[model samples]
Structures are given as structure tokens and as C-alpha cells.
Target: MSDGIIGLIGIVALLTLLLLRLPVAFAMFIVGFLGLWIVDGWNVAAGLLSSETFTLASKPELVVIPLFILMGNVASASGMSRQLYDAAYSLIGHVRGGLASATIIGCGGFAALSGSSVASALTMGKVSLKEMERFKYDDRLSTGSVAAGGTLGILIPPSTGFVIYAILTEQSIGRLFMAGILPGILLLMVFVLTVLILCLIQPSFGPPGPKTSFSEKRRALVGALPILVLVLVTIGGIYRGFFSPEEAAGVGAGLAILYGLFTRSLSFSALKEAITDSVVTTATVMLILIAAHLLNPFFALTHITETVGNFLAYLDLSVLGTLLFILAVYLVLGCFLEGFAMLVLTLPIFFPVVLELGIDPIWFGVLVVLTLEMGLISPPVGINVFIVKSVAPRVPLGQIFRGVIPFWLAMVATLGVLIAFPQISLFLPNTMFN
Candidate 1:
């Protein structure tokens, strides 16, 4: 059989394995190894395995993934979640829909350290969902806010998705990380604003939270000083050439551990939990990475990417039309594929199209991140929505899915803003790298 037919068969088999709830890594590994064997016998496929493992294991930027995951787990195990939520609440909790706003901002902050959106959703949901419910907030609004906001895990800096993209495309990891910053922050603000507007139009959507006194708000601000410093230190460190992505992750992890120890939050059990969480998360991610490496060659063999590029060029679609087409495709795919898999599957096809259209890779990276982020909130395969559902089973799964509507609107608006004004996505990377 032709390589093209074999590759297409590989794709179907891989997706079927995933649907059967086999581990994502296993699905990819099975299809990848089988495809390689079918195309080039067991001997050649075995030859590449050792070399592929060595190459992937030694990539410098990948070190950042574990460091950031460790930092996030430490932050979660420590009492940082409350501090983050309280700090946002101190500022916005008085407004109608304030808890939802706090939830959005809190999710963003937590996700900055987090590389996994499901973890972000579960963490923030556990921390804030009850409080939002206690205040009689809309079930859909409260649950949906977290489900939506948690997606910032991959949209913000310290994003593992950006790291994977960089490694896959041989783009600059640092630039890709910075590429996420402005767009992520823009989405955060849009979510908060969306909540504010919802509260204004329908105050019952969120009851106005009790106002806090100035002194109490002051205390809350003071309490969050550690995180603010870490954010500044890490981001500034990256911008100043003081550290590379790996180094910054190391710094962030150390700072988190130090903070945990200082606050007596780093008990032996907590340390074990953090290590376990980081290990599992890292293993899961690396499994996908390895499988994707095998799968990528399928596209390379079939020349599918080049074909898509040629087709797009033949269509002679305007640059705007092509960009919108890419966006629409990701939005639809996001609903089905988990973010990492979605990225691996499409970036090969889509990156070529973006290049053909002369779109900046740095800018397109951010755009893709934001677009798939919505998938984490969209049903019937909304990963983040499921994460929240796992945490708040009392809230119907349907309600959490419905809840993401406003945040979904906000995500689309943020994407529009980034698309309309490319610099919002471009400035940080250009400034930092240039």
C-alpha cells in the first residue's frame, strides 16, 4: 500500500484508540510505532527510537516544563490559592459579580505557574467554587468562570504548550513564551470585564459581595506581595537575559519552595505531593511528546502540509480570510482534541499554511494558543469544563458547560483584539528577543 494510505490509516487508528480511553501516549505510541514499522519495517523504526529518545530527552527548553509544573504544584499545596483569590477579591469583590471576577483573575494567576489547564480548573474550582456558591452566584456563571479561566494555563507564559510548539517548529521558546503574555493578560482582562458587564445587565447573575474595609484590603494586598515579586522577578529575569526559560523555571520553583518553607507550608507530606504531582504531569506530557514525534513523520511522508499550502495559495484567499479560516478550524478542533494532541496534530498542517500566507510564526503561535483555549471550555469535549465538573459534581455538567458562554465570548473577543492588532501579540516577543 502507498505511504499515504498507510498514514491515513494510522490517523484513524490513533483517534480510535484515544476514543476508547486508552492513554493518549499509548495511542500515539502504538500508531506511531506501527506506522513506522509498516512504512519501513521493524529494524528501521527501532533504529530511530533510541536516537529520538536521546534527542527529545536532551532538549534544553524542555527542562522548563518540569520546573513550572513543580512550581504550580507547590503553589497549589501551599495556601497560595486562597491568597491569590483573596487578593483579587480585595480589589473586585465589592462589585456585583465580584466573586466571578475574582475567580477569573485568580485562575489567571494560578495558571501562570500552572502548565495544565485541567489542574488549574480543579485547583481553582476547589478553592473558589464553594465561595461563589455561598454568595448565591449563578451556578453557570461561577462554574463557567473557572472552566473558562483555567485555560489560561496554556495561554500564559510558563506555558507548556508554547514550549512544545517551540520545540516542534524549531522556533524560539523564549519568544513563544513571551508571545503568550500579552494575549493571556488581554484575555484575563476581557474575562473580568465580561463578568462586570454581566453583573451590570443582570445584577442577579452575581450578588454584590460585601465591601471590605481599606485596612483589610491593604492586608490582602500585602499578603500577595510574594507572588507579585515572583511574577516580576521571573518575567523581568526573562526580559533582561538574566535567565533562559529553563533557568526561569528553576528560579520560579526555588522561590515557590522558599515561600512554602517560610510559611510552614512545605511539610514533608506536602513536598512529596508536589513531587508526585510534578512527576505525573511531566510523564503525561512527555508521553504525548514522544507519540507526537512519531506521528509527525506521517504528515512529512504524505506531504500533506505542502498540499494544504498549495491549495490555500490556489484559492488566493486574502490574508484576512486565511487567518479566519485557521481560527475557525482550531475552534472546531479544540472541542474534540485535548490541547497538546490538538496542537501536535494541526501545527504541522497549519504552520505551513501560516507560512504560506506570510503570517509571523510568533504571532500565529499566540493566536493558536488562544483559539484552542476556547476548546477547553466548549462542550461536548470541553476538558476544563470536565475538570470543573469533577470538582463540583453538585453543579450539573451541563450548567458548567453553559457557564463558559460569557468567557467564551470573552475569548473570541480577545482573539479578535489580538488578530486586529497583531502587536498586542507581537510586542513582548519583539521587545524581549530583539
Candidate 2:
């Protein structure tokens, strides 16, 4: 049989394994190893396994993963996430639907620090859910805002989603980071507008909060200053070329540790837990990256990317139609697979097709990440929905899903805007680097 046919069979088997509840890393590894053995030999497969693991581990860019994760874990353990929520609450809580709006804003801020959708959702959920409940906000508004907002984690600068995309596609990490900024802010605004429109139409869904006195607002802002500084320094330093992403992550993690110590918010045990959590998260990401490397070689051997590129060329669709078709596939996969899994699985096939169509890689990266954000809130496998559900267990799972529907539509709208104006995603990267 042709190696391309073997590659097709391998993909089918990988999907079956995923459906059978096998871990994504393991499934990819198994398929990749076997495919390599078939295309080359057992020796080549064995050699690749060791070399790829070590290469991925030793890469400097990979260090950013653990450091940024530690920064987030320390931030969470130090109660900074709470402070962020409080600051947002103090400023905007009095407005109609303001609390939900604050939750979305807070999630955006925490997302900058955490670079993780799950962490952003979980941290914001724990910090804001009770406050919204106390104010008698509708379960849909309260939970939906948190679930939708958490997706900002992947779109914002310093995002793990962008990092992985950069790694997988051999693109510039800094450029990708820059690319996400404007689009991230745009999506955040869309989410806030969605909340405003929802509350404007039905005031009962979100009642106005009590206005904070100036002094109280001042205090809240002051309390959150440290985290704000950390985010600015890390992201800004990268923008100014003062630090690489890995350096920024190290500095951010160190600052997080110092902030926790100064405030005494993190006890010895809590610090340990933060480190452990960072290690665990980093290990999982590393394994996925390594597995992707294994699978990449298999695709190269089988010319799967070239095959798909040819098929796409044969279709002769306009650029917009072709991009939409790729996005539709992502949307469909979002219903069944986790965001990261879908990313690793599809990028190999679609990325080449994108290049053949003369699309910008960084622009496409932002677009793909946005689609992954939608998946995080999409039904059936909406990871953020479940994360919010865990924090607000009394709310029905269906209710949280119902809540995210408006935000999901907002995501679709944001995707449309980005597509129509690629400049939104490309502007920062082009201007800043140029």
C-alpha cells in the first residue's frame, strides 16, 4: 500500500483511540511511532522517539511554558486573581450587567498572566461566582460570562495556545504573541458588548450593583497594582525587545514569587503546590509537543500535507471560501475534541493549505486560536463550560451551556470581523516588528 494510504489509516486509528478515551499524547505517540516504523523502520522510529523528546525538552522556547505556568499558579495561590476581580468589580460593578462585565475583564487580565483558558475560567469562577450570586444575578449571565471570558486566556499575548501554534508551525513566537494582542482585545470587547446587549434587553438577567465610593475604588485599584505591573512588564518588555519570551516568563515567575512572599499570601505548602502544579502542567504540554514532533515526521514521510494541499488546490475555491471551510472543520471538531487536541491534529494538514493560499501565518494563527476559544465554550466538549460548572455546581450543566450561547455567537461575530479585516490580527505584529 502507498505510504499515504498508511498515513490515512493511521489517522483513522488515532481518532478511534481518542474516541475510546485514550490520552491524546499517547494516541499521537502510538500512531506516529507505528507510522514511522512502517515508512522507515523500527530503528528510525526508536531513534526519533529519543531524539525528539530530548530536543523538545532542551529547547529554550519550551522554558517559557513552565515559567509562565508557575507565574499563573503563584498568582492564583497569592490571591491576586481575587484582587483582579475585585478591582474590576470596584470600577464597573455599579453599571447594569457590570459584574458580569467585570468578570470578563478580570478574565482577560488573568488570561494575560496565566496564558491558559482553564486557569482563567477556574480562577475567575472561584473569585467572582459567589459575588454575582450574592447580587442575585441570573445564573446564565453570571456563569456564561465567566465561561466565555476564560477563553480570552488563549487569545491574549503570552498565550499557551499561540506558543503551541508557533512551535508546531515553525513561526516566530514573538510575532505570534504580537499578533494576538489586538484580536484579543477585540474579542474581549465583543464579549462585553454581548453582556451589555443581553442585560439591556432583559434587565432582570443582571441587576445594577451598588456604586463604590471613590476611596473604595482607589483601594481596589491599588490592591491590584502589582499584578497589573507584572503583566505590563512581561508583555511590554517583549514588545520593546528588552526581553525574550523565555526571559519574560522567568521574570514574571520570579516576580510572582516575590509578590507572594511580600504579601504573605502564599504559605510554604501553597508555594509547593504551585510549583507542583506548574510542573505537572508543563509536563503535559511538553509531552504533547513531543508527540506532535513524532507525528510531523510521519506526515512528511507520507506527504499528507502535500496531498491535502493538492486536494484543496483541485477544489479551486476562492480564498474566503477555503478559509471558511477550514474553520468549519474546526467548529465541527470543537464539538467532539478538546481544543489542544484539535489543534495538534489539524494544523499539520491545514497549515500548508493555508500557505498555499497565500494567507499570512500569524494572521491565520490568531484565527485558529479564536476558533479554539469557541471550542472551549462549544457544546458537548465545552471545557470552559464544565470548568465554570465545577465552581457553580448548583447550576445545571445545561444552564451554563445556555448561558454561553450568546457569547458563542459573539465569538462567531468576532471571527467574522477578523476574517474580513486581516489587519486586525496582523497590524500589531507588522508595525511593532517593522
Candidate 3:
């Protein structure tokens, strides 16, 4: 059989394995290893397995993953995330739907620290859900806002999603980080706007929270000051070329630990737990990357990327049409597959087509990450919705799904805006790097 046909069979088998509840890393590893063995030989496959594992494990760039994860874990353990939420609540909690808006702002800030949607959702859900319940906010709006806002984690700077995308496409992590900034802010605004409109239409959905005195606002802001400063230092240092992404991550992680210790908010046991969580999360990401590297070579041997490129060419679609087509596929795949798995599985096939079409990789990376965010709240496999459900066990799963729909539509609108004006995604990176 042709290599292309063999590759196609391998992909089908991989999907079957995933559908059967096999882990993403193992499924990719199995498919990639067997594809290599079939097309090349056992010796070549074994050689690659060892080399790829070592190469990814020892890479300096991957160090950012663990460091940023640790920063997030430490922040969560230390009540930094709670401080951020309180600061946001004090400033805006008095307005109609302000509480939900504050939750989104908190999620965005925590996303900067954590670069994890699950972490953002879980931490914020724990912090805000009960408070919202106390204030009699509708569970749908409360749960939905947390689920949707948490997705900001992947689009903001220090994002693990961007790091993986950068590695896969051989793009600059700093540039991708810069590219995400404006788009992340734009999405945050869109979500807040959605909440405002929802509350306007149905005032009972999110009641106006109590107004805080100026002193209270100041105190809450003071509590959150350390995290704000840390975010500025790490991200600003990268923008000014004073620190590489890796350096920034290490600094952020170190600062997070110091703040936790100084405030006595992070006990020894909590610190240890944070480290363990970071290690486990980092290991999962690394295994996926190594598996992707192995799978990439198999796809290359079969010339699947080239074949896919040709098929796109045969369609005679304009650049925008092709781009939209690819994004549409992502939206569909997102319903069934986890975001990272979908990313690794498809980028090798689709990214070359993007490069061939001369689309800017940084802009495309932002767009792809945004689409992944939508998937996190999309139905059936809405992972963030599930995360929110876990935190608010009393809320029905269906209610959480319903709550996310408006925000999900808001995401669709935000996606359109980003696509219409690619400059939003490119402006920061272009201005900084150029």
C-alpha cells in the first residue's frame, strides 16, 4: 500500500484508541511508534523513541512549562488568586452583572499567572461561586462565566498552549506571547459585555452587588498588588528584550514562591503539593510533545502534509477561505477531542498549508488558541464546563452547559472580529519585535 494509505490507517486507529478512552499521550505514542515501525523498521523506531524522548526532556525551552505551572500552583495555593478576585469585585461588584464581570477579570489575571484554563476555572470557581450564590446570582450565569472566563488562560501570555504551538511550528515563543496579548484582552471585554447584556435582559440573572467604599477598594487592590507587579515584570521584561521566555518563567515562579512565603500563605505542605502538581502537569505536557515529535516524522515519511497541502490547492480557495476552512475543522474536532490532543494531532497536517499560503504564524497561532478556548466551553466535551461542574456539584451539568452558551456565542463573535482584523493579533508582536 502507499505510505499515504498506511498513514491514513494509522490515524484511524489512533482515533479509535482515543475514542476507547485511552490517554492522549499513550494513543499518540502507540500510533506514532507503530507507523514508524511499519514504514521504516523496528531499529529505526526504537532509535527515534530514545532520541526524541531525551531531546524533549532536556530542552531548555520546555523548562518554561514547569516553571510557569509552578508559579500558577503556588499562586493558587497562596490565596493570590483570591486576592485578585477580591480586588476585581471591590472595583466593579456594585454594577449590574458586575460580579460576573469581576470574575472574568480575575480569571484573566490568574490566567496570566497560571497559563492554565483548568486551574483558572477551578480556582476562580472555588473563590466566586459560593459568593455569587450568597448574593443570589443565577447559577447559570455564575457557572457559565467561570467556565468561559477560565479559557482566557490559554490565550494570555505565559500560556502553555502558545508554548506548544511555538515548538510545533518552530515559531518564536516570545512573539507568540506578544501576539496573544491584545486578542486576550479583546476576548475578556467580549465576555464582560456578554454578561452586561445578559443582566440587562434579565436583571435577576446577575443582581447588582454591594458597592464598596474607596478604602475597601484600596485594601483589596493592595492585597492583589504583588501579583500585578509580578505579571508586569515578567511580561514587560520579555517585551523589552530583558528576559527570554524561560527567564521570565523562572522569575515569575520564584517571585510567586517568595510572595507566598513572605505572607505565610503557603505552608510547607501546600508548597509541596504545588510542586507535585506542577511536576505531574509538566510531565503530561512533555510526553505529548515527545509523542508529537515522533508522530511528525511519520507524517513526513508519508508526505501527508504535502498531500493535504495539495488538496487545499486543488480547492482553489482564496487565502481567507482556506483559513476559515481550517478553523471550522478545529471547531468540529474540539467537540470530541481535548484541546491539546487536537492541537498535536492536526497541526502537522494543517500548519504546513498555513505556511504555504503565507499566513503569519503568530497571528495564526493566536487564532488557533482562541478556537481551542471555545472548545473548552463547547458542549459534550466542554472540559472547562466540566471543571466548573466539579466545583459546583449542586449545579446540574445541563445548567452549566446552558450558562456557557451565551459566552460561547460571545466567543464566536470575538473570533470573527479577530479574523476580520488580523492586526489585533499581530500589532503587539510586530511593534515589539520590529
Candidate 4:
């Protein structure tokens, strides 16, 4: 049998396993092992497993993964999220759709500190949804706002998604991290605009939030300064070569913990919970990384990426057309997988095709992450939306899904702009690093 045929069957089997509700990492591991055995026999598969697991798992740069995850968990467990939301609300909560806008802004800030989208959603959702609901905000709008907002975690600095992309593509993690800043801010603006427009068109979707005194707003700004400083320092350090990515994570984690402790907010129990949560989340991410590394060799043996490249070329697509095709695939697959998993799974296959087509990897990464953001908010498996629903049980899941449409449109519009003007993503990385 042909390697191509074996590859096709392997893909089908993998999907079938996914349909059967197998865990993603396990599914990849099992199919990859069989595919390797079929194409290269058991002896090669054994050696491949042993060496790939060690190399991928023990790498020093990988230390950043746990550190960043630890920082996020600490913030979540210690209730820093409320400080973020309340501060955002103090300024905007009086305006129409202010809470919704604040939700997006808060999510963006949280995303920077934490790379996990679900963590962002759960943390922010638990804090913001009740307040929005109390203001009689439309269920759809309130829930959707939080759901769409949580996806910012994947696009913002220190994002695990960008880290994995850099590792896989051999791009500089720093450049990829730098590249995300402009696009992340652009996307945040899109969500805020979407909320404004939605409230303008349908006033019932958002009642006026309680007005804060000017003095209160001033206080709120002061409260949020620490978050702003943290973002600037971490991103600045990375871009200015003040530290490597892992070193930056270590610094961020240490400072965040100290900040928590200095305020007398981080108690012993809180600290223990934060460390346990971070350790578990970090282990989960690392395991998935190990699985992806395991699968890559088998994928190569069967020439899957090469075949994908050949197939894309055979269509004689213009650059834009090829990009659209790849985007469509990601959007569909994203429904079943989180952005991080989708990125890890498909980059090996599609990135080769993209590189061949002369597309910028940095630009493509932003576009891909934006598209997956939509999937993260849409039903029947929008994880962030589910998170919002869980936190605010009175808000119907369907309503939350409906509310996300405006932001979803905003996300799509931002994507189109990026697609048309690659410089939106590339110009920053080139100017700063080059």
C-alpha cells in the first residue's frame, strides 16, 4: 500500500478517535504510533518515542511554560481578577455597554498575564458576568462579551500559542511575542467597537451602568496601574533583550506573587492553591507538547506535510486563495479543538504549504489565532461561552451564543484587514527586531 493511502487512513482513524471522545493527546499518540509502525516498523517507533519525549520534555526554554502558567493560577486564585474588573467598571460602567466593553478590556489585560483562554474566561467570567447581569444587560451580549473577550489570552504577550508556534517553526519566540502586540490591541478595539455598535442598535441589550463618581474613576485607574506596569515590563524585557522568554516568565511569576503577598491578599491557603493549579496546568500543557512532538516524526515518515504542500500547489491558487483555503480548514477544526491544540496539530501540515506559498509565518499565526477565537465562542462547544454560562447560570447558553455575533463579526473584519494588509502583523516585528 502507498504511504499516501496509509496517511489518509491514519487521518481518518484519528478523527474517528476524536469523534469517539478520546483525549486529543492520547488520540494523537495512539495513531502516530501505529502509523509509524506501518511506515517504519516497531523498532523505529520505539527509538523515536524515547528520543523525542526526552528532547521535547527536557528543553530549558520550556521552563517558561510552567512559570507563566503558575503566574496565571496565582492571579486567579488570589482574586486579582476582581481588582481588574472592578477597576475597569469604575470608569466605563456608567456608559451604555460600558461593562461589556470593560469585560473585553479586562479580558485583554488578563490574557497578557495568563496564556490560557479557559482560565481567562473562567476567571473573568466569574467576576464580571454577575455585575453585567445585574445591570439588565442582554444575556447574549453579556455572555458573548466575556466569551469572545477570553480569546485574547491566545493573542496577547507571553501567549502559550505563540510560544508553541515559535518552537515549531524555528522562529524567535521573542519576535513572535512582539508581533502579537499590534494585532492584539487591534482586535481588542474591534470588540469594544462591536459592543458600542450593538448597544447603539438595540438599547435593550445594555442598560446604562451605574455611574461612578469622578473620584472613583480616578481611584480605579490608580488600582489598575500595577497590571499596566506588569505588561509593559514583561513585554519590554522580552523585546529589549533584557531577558530570555523563560527568564521573563520567571520574573513575571515572582513579581506577581510578591505583589499578591505585599497587599496581604495572598494567604498561605491561597498560595498553596495557586501553586497546585499552576503545576497541574503546566503539566497538562507539557504533556500535549510531548504528544505533538511524538506525532511529528510519524507524520513525516508518511509524507503528510509534503503531500499537503503538493496538493495545495496543484490547485494553482493565488496567495490570497490559498490563504482563504487554509483559514477555512482552521475555522472548522477549531470547533473541535482549542486554539493551542489546533495550532500544534495542523502547523506541521499547513505551515509547510504556507511557507511554500511565500506567506509570512508571523502574519499567518495572527490570522489563524483570530479565526480560532470565533470557534472558542460559538456553540455547541464554545468553551469560553460555556465558562460564562457556568459562572452565571441564569444566563442561557443560547443567549450567550447570540450575543457573541457582533464580536464575531468584529473578529472576522479584523481578520480580513490582516489578510489584506500583512504589514499589520509584520511591520512591528520587522522594525523592532530587524
Steric overlap count per candidate: 0, 0, 0, 1
What residue runs in model 1 are displaced by over 4 Å at the alpha carbon?
none
Report the alpha-carbon TM-score of model 3 versus the true structure. 0.99
lDDT string for model 1 (210-316, tens) is 89999999999898788888877776789778888889999999999999999897787998989998998888888788777877776777666776777778888
The sequence of per-residue lDDT tens digits that candidate 2 reaches over residues 1-434 is: 99899989998998899888798999999999999999999999999999999988888888888999999999999999999999999999999999999999999999989999999999999999999999999999999999999999999978999999989999988889989999999999999999999999999999999999999999999999998899989998888888899899999999999999988998999999999999999889888889999998998899898888888778888998899999999999998888888889999999988987899999999999999999999989899999999999999999999999999999999999999999988877787634
Q: What is the C-alpha lDDT of each candidate?
A: 0.84, 0.92, 0.94, 0.83
Cα-lDDT of candidate 3: 0.94
All-Cα superposition RMSD per candidate: 1.5, 1.2, 0.9, 1.4
Candidate 1, position 14, lDDT: 76
Candidate 4, residue 91: the lDDT equals 79
TM-score, candidate number 1: 0.96
Task: By lDDT, rank the candidates, best first.
Answer: 3, 2, 1, 4
TM-score of each: 0.96, 0.98, 0.99, 0.97
Spell out the clash pairs found in candidate 1.
none
- The numbered model that scores best in lDDT is 3
lDDT preference between candidates 2 and 3, better one? 3
Show the lowest summed lDDT stretch of 10 residues, model 4.
425-434
Error of 2 at 137 (Å): 1.3
lDDT of 1: 0.84
Name the lDDT value of residue 304 in candidate 4: 91
